[model samples]
Target: MVDFEKEAIIENLSKVINTKLTEKANKFVTADVREFGFIGDGLVSDTAAVQKALDYCESLGGGEVIFPKKQKVKLSKAGYRSIWTWNTKTKLNRAYALLIPSNVTVNFNECELIANNEGADVINLIENKNASVDLTKDSNIEIKNVTINQSIDIDTFAYNSMDSCAVCFQNIDGLVLDNVKVLNTYGYGMRIIKASNIEFRNKIQIDKCLGCNIRLGWQTFIVDKVNINLLVCSDSSNRLTANAVQGNTLHMNACSDFVIKEFRQTTSNPNKYVGSVNINNNCSNVYLGKVYSIDTGFKIQDYSSDGSNQPYNIVIEDMYTEGILDRPLFYIMGEGTKINNLRCKNIGHFWINNGKYTQFGRAILEKSSFVVKGNLPKEVHFDKLYLYNSSAAFQSNGGQDVVTIKDLTIKWDETTNTGSYLKLLDIQCKFMNIGSIVHKLEGSMKDGGNQKGGILSCSTENTLTKIGNIIDQNGVKTENVVVTLSTGMSTMINLAASNIWRDSWLNVLDVELVPVDLTSSIVIYNSFIADTNGQSLKINHSKAKGMEQFRLIVKGYKHIKE
Candidate 1:
């Protein structure tokens, strides 16, 4: 067995990187596009010249294909066509400017490629014809420091041709994208599918992509290890008029073992349907380090059937979101997920549904709430949760085994206008242990709405002493507690009737007497347990002293649920 946390998975992934592609492109034979009849005068069509140069490099068994850095490369859609056929007999005719071969490096050398409106993708990755469709994976391909402008007028572009992109990678291995900037793409900026061992380095900037800025493996094969650094997604208009659009900053499906160091989504007006970072289908083992989102949030869900391919083992650290007041900041529905250090400005919710061993630790939500829904597994823990000026709403469906919170704190700085902040609804758990709660809200906690069964043990300071029936230290469903009562001659302490299993019996563990206003030494013999029942305890004094205050202590046990 391999320990993924202890071992350097990035280093092991680096071992599979094809460094020989760069070595051969830089240190070996090279073919400049100008030498192969490419005139960079910005008037003639350079598509044929670039293709000839690529063919010349492939003939040399793998070499460098370079364009001039001083001049601009203009590719026109003359007669080059690529056809993609679907299972439903739908054909898509795309005009790709150039086709790249394997075992070669194309260095634009910071030169920009101005593509025409009909040119779908600036460079072709996979061959999609009728009889000669290429499903074979391309090896050792690297494109670096290139800027591409599809120059598609979004108003006139065909909506059925939404598959257009700046670069598309399908069935490829060992690819690297360095300092790639794509502007005003009609469709996706980059579409990656069935590709492995890829590295997106330096800065990847995509502006005004009507579709998702970067799309990976949507209804396609499984992808692996797509590590990115310093990603930036922005829309110039801040809105899109396309009716059919995947309006997400980054959407991934069926991808695994990926790490994104940093991501920034600057679109002020994002679509309401999708999230900023949408991880759908069966993506697992993903680590998102830091995210700064505006007007959007994050979502992780598994759309598989019969629980066969549920996503698991995901982690997100240090997330800051704003302008998402109607939806939750983190909408999670998977197992073994952890979110830490979440700080949000406006009020939102954190929704958790149908998961096991999930944790939300060390979160400072100023005006946000936590909501638990649907059926959950046995072990779900929330540790170090702090809420300020927000409601604590935990809603459960039914029949949850256990949910534990280590340290829960709720505080308010205002002195007025505080309503019911703690609302627990329909919580049916066997053992829900919330350890050490400090609540400073104004009103009392609303009663648990229609709880079915089980115990909720919460230690509090001022607002509420207990939320549900108390469970003792030895895993017993006992309401045995020590409370201080000040009464005159006799007082009745009502026992919570929620201890339904042991309602027929009662026991007095110990008794202590303490006088408040008298100088006389009050002893235990002076007081006596006048009467006791399954629902109440009555303690009385032997002497007929009118309105004399004294203290009482008691303890007991009940049946334990196995």
Candidate 2:
């Protein structure tokens, strides 16, 4: 405490050299034109000085070039024009930050990197034609904690094409970007082309960008722990365009084996006129998790020429979709695609159309296959299923395909002018089980003229072995449930359980059943027929055997009325 002179000397040493040492350890490089032998800041305007600094650092075996703090370094006209043209034949070997010796970080704080004039692109990395940034040459290349602020003040009438990022990452690999924000860019956020093994962590915010958020071209990139908020909040009608117009948040074209996790995106008013995610052109082995969307969710299509064995092995799980009035939750039109554990709410339509003739929404494969479930607006002709909700639960247009449906529930609002409780057309499954409870139907049969009700119309050569009961309060009186069994061969229609209601009329109207054929050997047994008012059980028009063995137990009913 008494050594005042020693304390003053130590304080002076720390104030001069120790502080500079601490700043250097923090990786903050400040620019000094005087130290670099420049006449002034204006003379060193171009990237020539910057490139020379990088080259000098590399020539010194490996170091960092510092920029002066709180300095407004303007790029010369030649510098702005030449920034995109630096090393057009190969990637910049400067390696701003490498991984071997822990790399280097060139921090730009209170220092700006600006284009000389308006409407000029700030950075460009072209491939083959120009020099490319090859990150594959090294294991780890990191770009983090930096701010790229570009000016957008330009003439409205002047056709000056100002793009902040002309081309980003052409054929680069093993690159990492964290906490890197781009402000006021005209082009894409990061256009990755043919580069693989990349990871982007932390916050990547693109403010006032007039292009797609990000684009990946046939590359396997792992993106984890990232939060993106693109506020396309512009008053100009034309400015509010699609987030990812041509591609997806992460689009893969002919690429495979990629895992994308915990990816989130939100906008104030999404350009609802466009689709959010699009998976196209033979992209397979994709695993998606926790992908939430405000508008139309995700669409996958297999547009292969032969349409066989293309876009195979796709798995999507735990996805939530919410849209406005007229938007679908998920639209799938491809072969050999499996979706499981998908929860969707507040959607307009849900569809799964067949990409092939044989695979017309077919979801099962002869007891040795997967099961299809969940609510769908259109027909789902799957192999094995447990489905629920909407007017028609399951509709199979493809005849002679084996299908089984369990726990089927159908709901329709009478206020809406839609038709049918369930329509099963041209189905020939080995065994059919239908459990339907119609909550609402459009027009009641008591109002007559149009007999609107559930129907099971079959147009095939096989038999429908089992038919389940219908639980309705009005007792099948809403409309006549039609079950049409096609003719030519001996077919058996077995009513396993019957819960026919008090006012219900179970009409089994047969087609192509001739008198002699009916007398031969057709069997319809174990069926309860309850008719108190003598309503006829019309079994007409069929050419088959064994009709005498068709035992109908009539209980609590009067005689048939002509």
Q: Which predicted model would earn the best TM-score?
A: 1
In angstroms, give how far residue 285 of model 1 lies from its true place.
1.6
What TM-score, computed on C-alpha atoms, does each candidate reach? 0.72, 0.53
Which lDDT tens digits does candidate 1 get at residues 376-469? 4435666776666554544445535466667766654444433433332223345555554555433232233332211222221112122222
How displaced is residue 127 in candidate 2, in Å? 11
Report lDDT per candidate. Answer: 0.58, 0.37
Candidate 2 on 487-519: residue-level lDDT in tens? 533333333222232222222322222222354
How much is 103 displaced in model 2, in angstroms? 6.1
lDDT for position 240 in model 2: 27
- Which TM-score value belongs to model 2? 0.53
